[model samples]
Target: MQGFEWHVPADQLHWKRLQKALPSLRDIGVDRMWIPPGCKGMDASGIGYDVYDLWDLGEFHQKGSRATRWGPKEHLSEMMQTAQDVGIGICWDTILNHKAGADRTETFQATKVNPEDRNAAISPPENISGWVRFDFSGRKGKYSSMKYHHQHFNGVDWNETRKETAIYKIAGARKDWAKDVSDEHGNYDYLMFANLDHTNPEVRADIFKWSEWIGTELPISGMRIDAAKHYSAAFQRDFVNHLRRTTFVGNHDTQPGQSLETIIIPFFKPIAYGLILLRSQGQPCVFYGDLYGLRGGPASLSRPACSGKLPILMQARKLYAYGEQRDYFDKRHCIGFVRYGTVHYSWGLACVISNTVATYKRMYVGVKHMGEEWTDILDWCIETVIIDHRGYGIFPVAAKSISVWVNDKAKGRKSLARPFDTDIYDL
Candidate 1:
């Protein structure tokens, strides 16, 4: 597991070290690995959001070094190949909404906009704009010559002359804010640093061009789009459609109760994982924090502490829990689904999870599974359930517990065969 501000080596070096673990990760049924941002951040120590140069990915002697925090270009390539060899796909974290660490600043005319209501300009356009501009003298326009001017951005947070951090919209622009963005702050087009103007034809074209270049250059399976709500959703859709690869959505780590940690704590992680990994819907992403139980650090928020039960859960998902899915979301305080196996797959499972204490549900999976016995692979509940002749059965779970019952005849038995048992009654 990698912390947001963990003491990691350069990107290349980190990848080199990570390559050794690919086989182990693959053995655990981790099909995809969503790594951090590939491109160089504003600084080598950055997490790759404050993008200084899009073209410079730890190659040139920029940001006071020749490599990003992950490592150099060569190491990254080797890491990708190593993981791919083990059948693990790499998803690049793409940050296209904003950029920081500009080489210089430019002065222009702009208007101050309300932070809560970005659509309403507080003051008229005046010659009082000062924001970072990118010329990339260190890169010397190697792979791309797309220099960033103030006009390329919709708004910026900081003003150099006044030394104040306020939302200022660029002058001479037709629209005060980008269209069709999340209504969080009235208009969430501008997040931080220089917000990329997606409406600008050149800006849009340049980003697409960079995407194409990076996609061809690196052996990646897809991208993890950052700050999607801050940009045009249509543009994001177009970019993702063009890539024709897997794409996922997420953002920077936030405080607890506002993140997946809400359901990833010691009490409910198994239930949360069961709901995601066992289902036949969106591709489930296993966070490193959850996999290894990384906790709160000085820079990062407190991650949910967990027992080392993720591997067993992952194993269950791999060997069994395949085929068609049937949702049973009509129950109160409990929701579950059944994975019906096909001719080639027969270890289908029924996953039942509940947030309420001491819950039971009499649900129907299918008529075909009548008279079959099921065992809880979680080992938390020692009881077993049998499908009735009517294809309906009552499943019981202790307070705030998850039950993943697999067919007893199935070959998958790692979780079931484990020596330890968590008595739900004790919990």
Candidate 2:
């Protein structure tokens, strides 16, 4: 799943269309399946993250995700199994920072509007995404899920302001000025984006229970934690520990009870395992945002699936690095020298390079791959020798022409504008 991971409302998947394309996915280098966080109201099995009813895996969708019915409860695990059948791993995103959207009667939401229970309810800092925050205290106020990352700039609602900031503007932030305020609490603020009342011991307990169940119940291989930055470090640590401890297959079965696993691999990065000390423990992780990687002119935009090119480039820093010793090798030619070996080199390098190309072409001025991306490359790594290209012409390729470069002179000067796909294997 190296290419842009397709995102859509869950219920919407045209299973037939996808079923037909199953082979194609494997054909590409996509063996990893990722389901984003908070699928509520989408074609998911139920109300996404905001409102959860874990029991009903059947017909779990609310609205607008998809018309085609896909069992909700087991959807995730099923997908994981499906992916595994096809040599893929299904990775789920957990928005542990919050619950689904607030219910009018939910204590956290009610307290925001009523204020009487503000002291007893749970809501704090502000919502992690600042899209929805409930007044757990039954009071009124604007909130962010966490405080470590600054979201306010001089009361101008920095969240809104940052949208116009250089990179933000490039990412399509439309508002020049936006105002947000919370008053007369009691689920008064709507910015938190479904804040989880972790402050509530009950809330924490419930989440732990469900997460534990999933860990032991689902057949999935891993989790992608969402809004992890918003949560307390201790809580995050404990939650992951709990997940790792749960057992998905022990006895939690349909016959009597079943389980997915006590723990699936939780590779963390900015969102999930930020609190975990990767140095001390071999914590798996993923990094976000390589906005500048697309600067490579048409290469990034027009890249074909499983192009060994990108994969080669990604593995370069570690594979090449010459004499440079570093700890990690990453995108942006970002390389880490290794006085000592690290899991980074042993494990696969996964980077998130978004497919926002409309603006990319304009910014790079035709010269891409020059901008700053997540770097591990301490040196300019050498490139792989082109081996083959698939998705070729309406006509068949000459078997003898297999190893010719994309710019091969022998192809009668007929270079492909779309380089098509190229297979990749460990070098």
Candidate 3:
């Protein structure tokens, strides 16, 4: 039954502005802020993914990340500190999946500089820590299908075929990192992405080192495990276990394999963690990406074909996961669920209303079933916490000039549905 959600720029911003808005946001029922990892630009076509300097944010980005001008992580930390003082919980984006090439370009200047030393942290073969591609077919059991292609060059399942040549290209193995794993037809010996191999002990070590540093130093109150769907469910448990045990006291597991192998890694349920932790000492807010409906009934917000999963991992959410406050199907904007303490009310008797792209379509269908072209405001108040703004006021468009009314109430909140204002529940 918590209220609104806000996504703050993880980059630098006027701390004073955020400070000033704190009281207002609090008044508006925004309990948490999911901060971004970086402020880098990302073009949908070229970028199945985007890059950011995780450790080195010398300054803050002024514009949209998909738009440029990234800042230092310190700036974000400062804002987070302020948020804590204001009784707002902070959720930091855990961008552990991949990193930008810029940071690894110099490779290993921090280590002893020796041209012949291949073991250097920044060696040609060691482009980045934990970002190495896998040769699962050779030394270990790996599944290329597991990598999240949205961050890759082509954004498809190359791992299923396991073409060594294709693997080389995806790993960005150019001048020095190249190997003789390819054949004449340009097929891969093993298909894989530039993802960090969890099986590699050294890779695991680096991940922990960084995790401890950020968790302890930055006062990271919460986490949003990025690309959760791609990683092994068991590995997710191990990662979180390590995350939970973070003492912030020099945690670096150098033993390349089996730090805590006995424990069976649980399914990578990011939201499930929230379900458990929110009731316990762990942070309460975690986002579930449209997979709810597929598992339960209907109430997801993604296109199955869009993600390329064999079967759609999305749903057409009709009911929310709330306990007795359920809105009669047609009265709700969109359904959002929570597995709060001891409750699995999938019937969605409770609701939260917001004007989001994901919810509107489902809401529209519900509205159509109820014989209405649009919805009212009070209905939204019961369903989602309405926000008047969006990223600098620009709405998320289906295409150019096809605006979405995610943030219509805010004076400056932008909408992608420009030139043709669609009905966006103006109650």
TM-score of each: 0.82, 0.40, 0.38
Error of 1 at 89 (Å): 2.1
Error of 3 at 368 (Å): 35
Per-candidate local distance difference test: 0.73, 0.30, 0.31
Clashes per model (N, Cα, C within 3 A) = 10, 90, 40
Q: What is the lDDT of residue 116 in candidate 1?
A: 91
Candidate 3 — worst ten consecutive residues by lDDT sum?
310-319
Give residue 172's error in model 1 in angstroms.
Answer: 2.3
lDDT of 1 by residue, 204-319 (tens): 88888888888778877767788888898888888877666433222226324334323334677677777777788776767665554333343332332335566667777787
Tens digit of lDDT per residue, candidate 2, span 223-340? Answer: 7664454445566777778776774211111111123322222121111221121222332222111101221233442223122232222223223212312232342322111222
Q: Give the winner by TM-score: 2 or 3.
A: 2
Q: Model 3 — TM-score against the truth?
A: 0.38
Error of 1 at 194 (Å): 1.0
What C-alpha root-mean-square deviation, in Å, does candidate 2 show against the real structure? 18.0
